[model samples]
Target: MGKFWGKFLRSTAVICLLIIFAVNYRFEMKKTIDRFKKQSDENYYAMEKDVSAVNELLNILETSGNMYYKKNSNIGNHNFDFRYRSKDDIYVSTDDSHRLIAGVNKISSNWAVKKELDMSEILSESYKNISKVMPDIAYMYYASKEGFVNIYPEISKDSYPFLRNIYRLDFVKKELFGKGNKKEEGVSWSDVYKDPLGDELLITAGAPIYDSNTLKGMITLSLKSNFFIKKIDNNLITDFFIVDQKGNVISQMSHGNEEVTSFYDRLPKKLYDKRYKFSDMKPCDIEKIGKYYVYYEQCNSAPWRVYYVTDMVKLNAELLRGNVVFISIWLISLVFLYGASRRKAVVEDSQQTIEKLQVMLRKSDREVEKDFLTGAYNRKGFTKIASSELDRMRRYDLDACVIMMDIDHFKKFNDTYGHACGDFVLKSFVRTVVKNVRLSDIVGRWGGEEFLVLLPETDYKGALLAAEKIRKMVEREVFYYHKQSLKITVTLGVATLNVRKTLEKSVEEADEAMYSGKETGRNRVVGYQDIMSKDIKWKK
Candidate 1:
């Protein structure tokens, strides 16, 4: 009888030990999987940030270029070789009386150079015609080292000479020889190249002067490419580079010394081969390149690929490590509880219940944070995250920007089309916004037709430029439904958190600027400073 009792007790003890070991093993495996999942999630978020920064940077570059172009179109013609002394000697002679012969001549000698002139002659003709037509004659000159010389009329030569020389003329070095002004050379021109004649030039608009396919020289109607580098160097944080189809490095914001191989050099070989299907947003780990969160969009129309790359591991490792620590603590606590629990049945049941509850809570949290339609952050989620960011900025004394956007005439579209169309429009809008916004920037559906974006470590000017880009992208996207095409436009209001007294103030300022955009024109971007200067009252 004593031996039977002892054998039964030993069998029970062995069974219990086996059960405990199995449960603990399963739990540890789950923890490992969960750890992987958590890492993946953190990586995903970091990738998002990287992508957003790229998009915003591209947008800023594009918008600034556009603005510069609009401001000074005839930038190349600002500086002309005008014989100031031989003003009286210059006679408007032509093949016919109706035509005029305008050529350069030496002031000291009577020897007149009949069309021994550069491309500026054509511009001078145009200016002459304009002066004949208009009462007031203001002219500017943009001298080129080679190719067509540019001429502008009705411009303040003193003020915009440098701009004209740098942007429009494509002059490598410009020397302004004036009485009072010291000879100014090597001055980096602004991206916003403004001609005295009110023409704007874009640095990106590289309109080359080709002499029958042989690259003699290039003509730019905007700032020099070097100017772009200097500006980017001054403002942008992330490393930026412009690459051509042959993988030749055209320009770089930083990290230019790195070899320029194929665009594939930046991406995995598999991704390079399958370029068409490659995701614009992906986190890739490179050995010496470091962990880069890369986003690239091929310019099918242009001979270029616009890409943004950042060191992902270095930027977000701290956050990821912190998250891992928290998860490790939770797992350790669970393991301790499992080891200490004596009642096997009760313990298993309790562990299962806790796990289920934790899953439920996480799911609930995700649902609240994510947009139902697009799986992006909702307004509330954006606010929460933005608040956290604001706190961080305040603590760190960092820069940040916010952009407010609204669909143009969305109400009219809803009225003209059905509610179904409206929903489609909303979905389309969200898609475009998501596609354009930087992964670092927070984009959310603020309300029905309104969206908000938070750009960390950016200034008001940059935010305004970013908003303009989003507006342009939304405008460009073709929305098709049932063989019907619908064009969409948006108005954006930009404000910088770096400038505002408080986060609330920034939001309010941005909101007001957005309303101003609505009032001024439906499709435009209004800066917060402009709104405040107007003293218009509004709320966020």
Candidate 2:
């Protein structure tokens, strides 16, 4: 009986120790999790703050650079006055130079060239002042509408032949003189181009010169790729670079004799393997690769993305260091407590699995059907749903209508406000339309800034009313981005399905009507019937 009493006492002591271990283990685990969560939030906020600061700096610089041209290019008379003269009056003719000259002259007014304004001293002094302010500016120059270039801190003539007739290049033809470009007031940012002279990547920022309504010439500033990298390379937690909307790297720091322009070859495989529709990426979304965390933020004034990459292995190392003691204690406790907790853990696991399954089922439809950018229907999903509804309507001989709409001056908006604002505008547009339309109506993204609304069981008049409501809502909506308010408008075309028209043909007719509205004036809705009365040649 004494032996049995001793065994009972020892068992009681062991059970007491187990309970103590479990409580301590749970407390430590909670503390560790809370600590890490706090650290993670701090780091995330720090990163976001840094990104915003850098983005703001870049925006200010670009804005100032553009304003420099607008203010300086209106020097004197409307004449293309180039004061800097070559040391030797040596002239070389080439097909490229001739084409460039012709391109520049094509945009110039009929006014004769005047030698009256000698702004050489002004140009040289302005360059000196600008250099003091912006040391990264490698070169500043002015080009005449006749293809003559006056470069500050002049170099030998043999070094830059292309500068002599810059208008011949596609950059001049497309960016500066392209259709729908407001040449005089607009600034153009060149893609990363290989510099023939230095064999390095370079980007040119230019603004057109204007006298009243005529294109006189342009002022340009060139910066090396390294110059941009230096501006934001001070951070240790993340490394970032600029990329265009198409995911092509614009300017990045070169490494160890690697060619800076070999973006597709040298960039992360993930960037090249899949296209980033950027529209789908949220501001706080962190994409995880094998051992890296990728974050991107859009520039407020450019159609470019600033991508930040952090090494997850390095991040985890910092996280784990703080939790070592807790982890060890937890592991030891787990061995002793497993048998006691096994049944309870099994029940919890089952419950968690069922809950996860239910959540997955609910999210699957949204994942499959929604557009990544605007949360609208993707093209394929929309087409399928719309076609099915159209088929059912046809069988019942019910009336249905569709509208095609596009944001007016969207490209201009992007150029002026930056791609980030463009994204904001798109989301706002979708939200406005969705709010005004019936819940039964379907809105889908047809393409960039283009949307299609499927109005089931609605007539042509109803569709027009819906379209007009959307148009007015967009115009009246105050779009706020980065503390600035912007106004935008849309043009919509309405068409109703008839027994004679297929569902696809009805969509096409609506698209055509939208184009007609665009041709006449934007921010208005046009009905297909209105255009059908006229002999209109629709663009293929």
Candidate 3:
């Protein structure tokens, strides 16, 4: 009976202690949530103001943009040369125009060029006129369905490459007004996107021009991503993000030096995909997703959603340490400090997870063309990019060359050493090739132990010199496989792309020339045109 009584008392004490802990946890969580919600209210107001300001600014640009098209549609000649062509065929007239920079995806008739250039000039004048009055807009542009794009705000002589990048932007190709959805009526907004040539983040408001029910082009106004970010971000408060309909970030607050990427990757899929239905209502809060307290507002004006995320881990413990909540303040403070340290660790791990998501995001698109092992272009990617560049070379009457090289006795490395050593050799070989090539040049792994190199503005002689230099460097470099040392040589075939031949034909020619080198001598450079010099007969 004495033992039974003792056991019962101890059991009762343990159960009472657990109940106390449960109550404390509940109280603390409620207090933290209440405080977080209040802060979110302030954040929502600030962000709303920011969005409104952006809309207002866009409205002014829309007015200016409309005026450009409102003017005469008739073509006017200002003696802009139709005979002029840029080297890459990516740019048209950049240096000549002081206030307007022009680029084209491909050249068209002189009549079309005159028409595009004339409209571009009018747009440039409108941008210039507006700047004198309202110095608010950073830049304005017009993108035609044909290929022409005029970016106002004069690009310098050497900065023409930047203009070309703008012309080749994905938005220019597909979503001129963020037209992925094509939801809005006029002056639709582009999903926030980063500049391919630089670090600057930008979003565009574009108004499409229609000619009797046929879609023409768009007049776009550019705004920095910060124009939206600066409004709601407070380091002491919640983190903010402007997410598009597709869960792409339009703008975001600084989260240290870590780059902000796809928002869908950061949160649970259902948050944007399913869970709560977003309506054209007031800013609303989502109680919790995982550990984050989220609130969002769908902009009635724009097709994007604004999010405020409150990390429960970062919440202050002032409420838990208050006189009403705690009898021993310092003791509670010590416990809170300990908990905060653990939460910091959780936050660090979360950041590492986010970094991994960034890699996953890149894999979805960019990696489709990328080689998994070597980071070089795979066959498909190589074919696409090389074909484009080759077409440009042929059309613009510029010079380029192709080099098809294969490892001499590459099978020996795999058979004798092992596939691991073979892979190491292949990786090392690619490194050497890439290091020897110019930044403008492209290298691709056509297949196992065989690679393709595209050199822009390179003649046959230059291509041969480059190939020999690559061969000599590769021959001299030592390879390591554990204790054993190995060296390898490459047989390269050179072919010029300036001729009126397709990319496939040129690649075939280069491949044949490489085979000729293998037939004649194992480790030598050979040119397709000089196949007659060798005994091997190459089919034209």
Candidate 4:
């Protein structure tokens, strides 16, 4: 009877100890879980907003293109001065010397150049006023397959050859243009990149321009790559960061000391590989990998999984710091009597380490400065060196001229035959100019049916002579096609830049002369000097 009574007392004591273990640890677990839940929720909404902002930037670009298509047709030239550049838009150009004023808004036979002014205006406004729409947007750009990259909040050419480098990224080809991605996910975060200007990492989210299922180009916006990792608090989450799908840790310092970075290396493959187990819209998951207690959740905005990890042994020691006697009694009760261990303390790490994911993107081949079809300089390539050539002319007090040419009624050919025949005629026209002109003269496709010729060391008369020769040759050449032998004529405008003036003013004068020829007969050569005849005249 006495032995049964002793056994009953010991049984009651064991039940009380079990209750204490569940209560103490469960409270700690709940606190950590709740904290992680709140942080993840905040990050999810922020990421959604950022990705949405990038998508909106594409809309702005397309809207501007549509606006250009609807511009006033009667206006001979769409002159948008860059000096009156809006406060909101950043001025980005291949030629920094001409950055102060726009010199190339000239109307051509094609709609391509005319709309650049409208795009520049609207893009600036989008960047300036979008502060109200999405205040966190610091960088955004539209990268056209036509070889132009328009970025807001001007980037440095020395620091970042943005136009050349941006086109060569894998993200631009695959992710933005939709090869490996589902259509429902309209925009997606790119693998992070090291910012050229700073130590920080950046990520891109953008959409591509598709015309009836044909990809035209892409537009993108950028934000910090640590969007998810920033949610980790050093005091609360000592070993917290984000990892890519491959389990590479993207560690960035979140206003903490630099010493913290070297503390933890890459995250284990065992953890990130198990990311699928943490279901979306579910509770924060708690897992033990080796000696570490890991809490994790998936990010909705970026292609990353966020994690909070701490050493289990260290956490228990810290938790038992204040409850020394209670923990002692609890440990003794469990180990000596019950043959169980006390609930290990649920606590954070003693020191914090942010693991940064350094994404090394291979520089794609950047051989796009020249025109792909015609082999002449495209506008982008021409603009890169045109300014320096003119500056040299000015420094030497030598004569130089720019000739603007356009094929008269070129669209009728595209309408009559298919676009293929029209493309053939353009190639032939370029061939004739390159064949006849001096080796020093530069030829470039200005836009649509419009083309440009740079005459170095030439007066208006010399340029006119050269322009007339090209005009006569183009008038004579026969485009022998299988369907029909087609004939075309070109109008030429010449402007002399011996007098001091901006390139835009000279190009504007040249464009004006070209339009005059188009207005009169369409096969003649006109000189800006002969028309303007002001203080600036034809210099020999």
Winning model by lDDT: 3
What tens digits encode model 2's per-residue C-alpha lDDT throughout 435-473? 989999999887678899999899888888889999889
Give lDDT tens digits, candidate 3, residues 106-158.
54656645655566566566677655543445667777766666776765545
Error of 2 at 187 (Å): 2.2
What's the best-to-worst order under TM-score? 2, 3, 4, 1
Model 3 TM-score, 2 decimals? 0.45
Question: Could you give the candidate ranking by lDDT, starting with the highest?
Answer: 3, 4, 2, 1
In model 3, which regions exceed 4 Å deviation?
1-35, 56-74, 77-85, 90-98, 105-119, 125-139, 156-170, 175-185, 210-216, 235-238, 254-260, 267-283, 318-540
**Cα distance off (Å), candidate 1, residue 383:** 1.1
TM-score winner, 1 or 4: 4
Weakest 10 consecutive residues, lDDT, candidate 2? 95-104
- The per-model lDDT (C-alpha) reads 0.50, 0.60, 0.66, 0.60
What lDDT does candidate 4 reach at residue 215?
45
Model 2 scores a TM of 0.47
* Candidate 1 stretches greater than 4 Å from native: 1-367, 534-540
Alpha-carbon deviation at 200 in model 1, angstroms: 70
Each model's TM-score?
A: 0.32, 0.47, 0.45, 0.43
lDDT of 2 at 532: 77
lDDT of 4 at 63: 52
Model 2, residue 376: what's the lDDT? 88
